[model samples]
Target chain A: MTTTARPIRRRSAFMRNAFPYFMLAPAVIFLLGITLYPGIYALYRSTMTGKFKLEFVGLQNYRELIVDSTFWESLYNTLLVGSLTLAIEFVIAMTMAALVYRDPWVKAWRIVFLLPMLLMPSAVSYIWKLLFNDGRIISDLLGKLGSTLGNIDFMSSTSLARMVLVITDVWQWTPFLFIIFVAGLQGMDKEVEEAARLDGATWPKIFFNISLPLLRPVIAIALVLRGVDILTMFTPVHVITQGSPAGHTETVSYFIYRTAFKSFEQGYASAASVLVLIATIILSQTLVRRFFRSGTEA
Target chain B: MNAIRKLTLSLWAIICALPIIWFASIALRPHNEIIAPQPIYFPTFTTETWAKIFAEWPIMNYFKNSLLAVSGSVFICLLLGIPAAYALARYKFKGREDIGFYILSTKMMAPAAVAIPMFVLFGHFHLLDTVWALMLAYAAMNMSIVVWIIRSYMMEIPHEIEDAARTDGASDLRILWSIIIPMCMPGIITAAVIAAIFAMNEYLFTLIIASQHAYPLSVALANFSGGSDGIIYNAIALVAFMAFFPVLLLVILIQNHLSRGLTMGAVKG
Candidate 1:
């Protein structure tokens, strides 16, 4: 009886251990079917170059991508817009987070603040496109602010168009960073901050030293997530600028999109897509690593 | 110092609210007034734009399509995400952490990166220009978020409750249905709401996959900007307002869950 029970017990343990994979099967299979398979297929398609008839060109598409000035320009634009937006968003969100962390009334106003983030991106882009019109509210407001802005087309000028894209992004996304920062601030150990204050640490010192370090994980996560998103920003550019004025506002994602759909260069677009995937992976891995390290330390 | 801070915050709030307020005003104004050079910060009210949106545009069809896509995506997320979240939360398994990271890493890949491939795949399967394609794409896009959010919530529930249920001869599914799910209702709801909002707002994949047949409000509103009548600002505003209103209301109602949801529980309020 004891010998028979022992085998049964071992078999039951095996079944119990296998239960998790059973539970995980559906999600894994679904994601594999949808995301992973398609991604791998894209990578495979990137090597071949042809519209209708396929020809395997070893590294040819990638070589062309390297020499492609337009691709490089879009890449540069993506980075510039992404970094500028991040810097502005971080500063504003951090300041606002600091201001609102303790005030009950202000904390309650988070919902209002988050309104922009909540709206559909396309809708936000559409609304901003209208506002950026030559004689619209935004232009009039700028004129009122003592600038020689006489019917300036915001989207036609390359510099102004880029600035407008950054501003619109900052407007829509700062609230998200603000919410995260506020949450990070609230989640901090009050004792450490109060102790620092009692120890004659100035507010700025406490912020720079204690609060910032403590909030590193949240900030890092926000930066990476927002960075990835900003890099892929499409709707605003597509709707407002359409990558016009000599394609100055064209982002990497938008360029890839136009290449794939508009120009129908599936092979080259796939090559670009593979490069994007690689960049995303490298950046996400580094950022997520930093986030995890800080998270564990905190 | 406190007073100065308060003043600054109030000023910032006004700045933040300005565009939205302007948007609402534009949406309500007469078309001629919208194009008037003298910026109408506050407009005399009119509903002609809204009236035209309903009567002339296929706004309702857009709304219905948006509803179907969002609901289908959310349903898929919940159906698949819940079990995976449960396993991650409860059971210790080989490659558990790796699997979790893999799921999250999938999100880092932008939808555009896979757009061409997905387009081809859907086209091959004759799924293009269908809401089902949009639903499936969105479901794939949002599944990671659902798992992450719901798993975080499930982790917060004590394991002893499940242990007790197991001792009482309840199967894992039974405990999940009877005990675990009931306890994690708020988390599930938050996950579902976030997924729905994402699906509703999804533009790129929808734009690529479904042109006219499955065009949601996002595509419709985008198309309005390039309409033949040449940029009726008020009508565009009205359509934008209509497209945004439902999600805005939902966000306000569930504002508590939203902050945490948006961050995927990275920062808890």
Candidate 2:
């Protein structure tokens, strides 16, 4: 039913409802000014191809993207990074959260684990870049221990650069996953674990049978949030790699960068964005639905 | 078994704490010692590098950009977010769930993907290289945050409060201003804090949209590390400390709310 046509049960509903609308008005203005203007502007630009002037090319930009090598490479790298990072984070966060909850020293351990949450993403990415920064400093340090690369080139190589990136990103963000997982644990009633233990359940059995099932929503939330987050890998790839050594490290973000600002292919970039937007929406909805369901179910 | 469990816990904690320690060690080291073949056991700390950070870059401007962007995004998000969240939580409107997801799905979309178009579009509109652009960009970026964070918090407060406010002759608007908002204060604060941190360290949009005059500390930090004289690792470390210290301070202060929100507020409330 339409908003206006809906029947009001009581006269007070209107008066009471005004508060939420009133409360929401400023937020509405805030979002609209930022999201709508930019979104519409992007949409408008997606239709045009040349100079400051607008030319409507319809779906040509979208058609070009299908054949664009860099676009496909970026798509490949984004999936590769996002999926892998999520897998690693999920396993570690779940196992860590489960184990930590059993300890009496949880408060102290929990606090320490959460420290990285405070570190800026940019800073974390920086440290990762530093960790793999040429691996020269590290290799030399390791070299002193009699470990030589032999014929192995580290950062200069594509595979090694990508590996360094995944490792670094995980190092920086695992704390976030830890925090979320712990929060999920804390929200759970203690009796569930206590009851499982009373039933002669082993710790591993209890975890798989009871705790894991209970924490599915949290797991889902962590995965979805982290999964979506990794797709925009920019800082390290931008600063550390610059999609370097023959665009081996190029992510969708970097691809967009080269196209729009670097190549001035506004239409093409906008077309790529529409596809990105669709993928993001589908993935986010699936993950968030699980989050919403768990919230309501709990 | 007991020892194994304890060891496992300790191992995890060590793994978690090591990176921050690495960062802290670098920050504390003097230039001569920072990038050494072997790290020194004990180090002398100097403010000279940090002092130079301010003197060299438009740090204050960057700070302003960060503060403005974070505060701007948070304020706007709260303004719009509180309402949308309220509508979804309290009302049984048709398509409410869809609407909520519609709002939140934007969060899933990679900023980098959207950013490509934005960079090009901003150039065409002659809006390139402005703090206002950063502000505008941040506002959109933060919409999902405001909506989710505030909505969850609002859910915690019972609808009966609004019902009671209605019987007392309070209009919907009045009830939200007087009752609902005050109740959600902590959550809104959390959103604002997150926004602040995101804003302060935000490198991408600011780096793209704004120029040298508007160059933020993050960009300046990147520029300085390589260019701030290759020899003075101490100075660069000091600069690194300057760029990150404030975020650390914020996280420490608001650690409780932020931690709480991250875990359950969005999902459980």
TM-score of each: 0.93, 0.87
For model 1, what is the error of residue A129's alpha carbon versus the real structure, in angstroms, after optimal superposition? 1.5
lDDT per residue for candidate 1 within B1-269, as digits (tens), equals 88999888888788777778877787788776766657666678888567776787787887788889889999999999999988888877788877877777777877888899889989999999898999999999999889988887888888788887776667888899999899999899989988888888888898998788788877777666455656666666666677677777777766777667876766676
Candidate 2 residue-wise lDDT at A16: 55
Q: What tens digits encode model 2's per-residue C-alpha lDDT throughout A159-223?
A: 78787678767766777787777777777888988998898889889778777788886777667
Give the proportion of true interface contacts each model preserves, from 0 to 1.
0.59, 0.45
- After TM-score superposition, the amount by which residue A193's alpha carbon in candidate 1 deviates from its true location, in angstroms, is 2.8
Shift in Å, residue A293, candidate 1 = 8.4
Could you say which candidate leads in lDDT? 1
DockQ values of all predictions: 0.52, 0.46
**What is the C-alpha lDDT profile of model 1 across A1-298, one tens digit per residue?**
4543323112387778888899889998988876677678878889998889988997889999999999998999888988999999999999989888878786467876777886778778867777886337677777799778667788778888998889889989999899888888888899999999999999889999999998887888888778778889998888888787789889998999999999989999999999988887787666655553211111
Candidate 2 lDDT for residue A196 = 81
Which 10 residues in a row give candidate 1 chain B its minimum summed lDDT? B222-231
